[model samples]
Target: MRPNYLVIILLIFYSCNKIETRDEVYPTKLYEKAKYFQNENISDSAFYYFNLAKNDYVKINDSTGASKSLVNMAIIQCNNGDFYGSIETSLEADKLLRNESDSTVKSTLAANYNNMAISSSFLKNYEESVAYYKKTLQFSNDAENRYIYNNNIGDALILLGQYKEAKKYLELAIFTKDSLIYAKVLNNIARAKFLDDQNYNPLPELNKALIIRQNNKDIEGQNSSFSTLADYYLEKNAEKSLLYSYKLLETSEKIKKPEDQINALQRLIMLDKPNYLKYFKRLTAINDSTQTSRNKAKNQFAVIRYDVEQKDAENKNLKLRDAENEINIIYLSFGLGILIITLIIGHFWNEKRKKSIKIEKEKEKELEVKNTELRYSKKVHDKVANKVYHVMSELENTENMNKEVLLYKLDGIYQISRDISYDKNDVALEHNFSQHLSQMLKSYSSENIKVPIIGNEESLWEDVGDHSKVEVFYILQELMTNMKKHSKADKVLLDFSRENDLINIVYSDNGIGISEFSPKNGIQNTESRINSIGGTINFDTKTENGLKITLSFPAKN
Candidate 1:
């Protein structure tokens, strides 16, 4: 009895193991069933089984198997006119097979690219389709796939109006040993030639392709050949065109491709047959049905993708919420510790901030006092010292004392001192600044010297601030004094212009320029005044060319 019980137990364990093994192999069986249905042209069943296989493979983490199913599903989706869905599925397969090394895996990768090319072509994305076909060529080591991809790329180029480029790839496909592929390439080349020039006859190549398709019993190829021949003969030979168009319609219906059937029916309608209205009605019906099916398929695909993305987002949100809860607990604990430390450090930081503020205020006060002293010194130097120096020079040069000239000089000095004391040195601001500036320039002119002023419109000085006006007046005075005393300039040009918010002044003189001179008191004073007004001055000097100075500043209103 014990021996019998052991045998029963061992049998039950073996049965359980066998069931587990069968479960493990189920995805491969599902993939095979999908392939069988796809070959039979039962697309609905094929899609159902392919999805099943894909989900099963994904459950087992079998990426290669899932990719294979996905590629096939993408092809079916493309045929059903779900081009956007097909593209997404093909990209998913491409990601899975990116690092695969097996020869079969490589073939699948090539097929994935080819499927993407076909889908893009149907969507009228000719350039992207051509790019995907080229990618297909890169992975396609087999001659069959290479020839097919070359032909597909060439056809897409022809559609894009690149007949010359299309001929090159078509010729490559023509080199294949497969007669069917060679015939297809020849037909495409002939069509490209005919389209490029209507005078070219494509009938010879069409006849050759037709013969090959008929011999091979390839219904789809026959349909394509008949359609091309019918279009080629439509204007030249109406009867022959009608016969081929009818043949194309028959073959298309036999192949059960609604798009092809509608195309053939439309061609027949264009032939002006006795039953033209009948063909037109049939064409309309088939076209409407085809469009409806495509729209339904696209909608279905979109719904499925939306649902998948939504579920994925929901799952991600759940995971993030769980992680956030755990992190919040840790952060709360850490925050309490950080808060205590921050309170301790903040007290010290507050004391340091107060000390820093006090030091900054002291520095600011010192800067203000120094600035006040500098302003007083500049006023005395410009107003008192300069006038005193001129008086002393006049006294030394004169042998007899001229009371009127001395009194006139003394009165000018007293007025200048009063202007400096009141900080109202800009006499030009009392009248038109441009006219005053012109009068000042004329003062620097003599029998041997010429001063040409240009672009000095009164409007240009309208935006000058009071302080900037005073500084500018002093700067010009210093420059003219330097030129009169040292430059020996015969001609001077002063141009002033306002652009946007900036005032530009160009001062140039033809003089016996200094070879290399340091800044004298006059030049130093000019620079200081310009700096006080926030203006820039640049000097261009050469012994032969004299000196040119450009000054610019932001116009202050």
Candidate 2:
């Protein structure tokens, strides 16, 4: 007969209700697979699948499914001899259960608590086990469950030396018509009566239960009956006690329960002195190995749970990163769409204004030919032409142009064209030059492309002249646009460094190199602007892997 510690493990699985899964695959399939393995006695595989099912249930917000899976996992742990781990796992299931719930959930909650009680009993925490059995009864609505919990509570109370209270619950348990359950309770009642009052004769009830257990072929029940009878006869009849003790040890070994075998050996060592040394050695051996088995069980279960937790955390982190990346892509695309629309409208409006000015000038030339020609030429060059050409050039160069900047430039041109004599030379000085440079390079990034910037801190640009900053800004801007348009590149990197009074930038892209480099703007604009700021630009067009352009310039005048 297995120890009563194994009794609760049986109690739970027999009575617990499985959560009904109506065709949904994810959690339901996992639950089914776990059940198949559990029924097949593949405990490790069962625990693994049940844990997976619990995680899946949590993801879908099915509290009932998660609780059921946890309960089953706890039972598996109990069966595997990991009593502490079993109690911990059962508590996890309890957290998922509600205090007041539907009948099915109530039944689940009862079974979960019952598992805790059984595992606690095995660990010799009888007070805690009694408390847990009472909790199990609290959720139980079924009369059969009431009987079961009563018997369990009685068993634990007997362990605590409360024989009178143990008999009270055992009497309630004996009211059941179940012959097997009746036999179990009858033995407990007999043990309690004899324990509480040494004068009380329990042989009749004990013998009757033993007969019923034998008739039913209840091996665990017979194991209990043998133990109870042997203890009862130990003080009164030495010969009968020795006979029952031998039977207990034989039956315990047949069932292969180390705890029961230990109990039986203990009785024999006390009763039969001839083989005391032999029985003592076997008892010691089993005791040592039992603890080893328990520790091994605890470690194996702990490792399995720990590994699953780590994998779940990794999966969640990966999902969170994916979600964030998707959101960024959406924002970038939306901003790009708005920018393109603004540029299109701005371009058409500017073209219309320039056309209107030329027509007016032509009409005036017919009336005051010489005067209008001179006035028209001066006004168009000074106000209408330069400011409009500036706006158009800025529009052409900047793709992700800021709305406020575009609006400011257009308003400047509008006012300048109206005054025709306000020649305000805009230097385009920016206080936060480093930030602007960083944003410009990063704006080119897409889902398929990565733009990583390095060492472009504000401190690096501190001593740089405004003319140099502005020229470098546009120079870098041109390179980015050029790469996007023709490089077919997937990666772009800009590494910046400084040496005392000079700032150096090396721009690279993993794209088809300068063999396909078609330089537009015959003016050599990049070279001219670099030289104006005491800067030199070098292009390595020989590499096949990508483009590497190095620009070195004095940080200050």
Question: Per-prediction RMSD in angstroms?
Answer: 24.7, 30.1
- lDDT (C-alpha, whole model) for all candidates: 0.81, 0.82
Global lDDT of model 2: 0.82
In TM-score terms, candidate 1 sits at: 0.49
Model 2, span 307-331: residue lDDT tens: 8899999987985686566545544
Candidate 1, residues 399-439, lDDT tens digits: the string is 79789989998998888877765767456566777787687
Lowest-sum lDDT 10-residue window in model 1: 1-10
Candidate closest to the true structure, highest lDDT: 2
What is the number of backbone collisions in each predicted candidate, taken in the order shown? Answer: 0, 0
Pairs that clash in candidate 1: none
Give the poorly placed runs of model 1, Cα more than 4 Å off: 1-26, 100-102, 299-557
lDDT agreement of model 1 with the native: 0.81
Supply candidate 1's per-residue lDDT for 14. 54
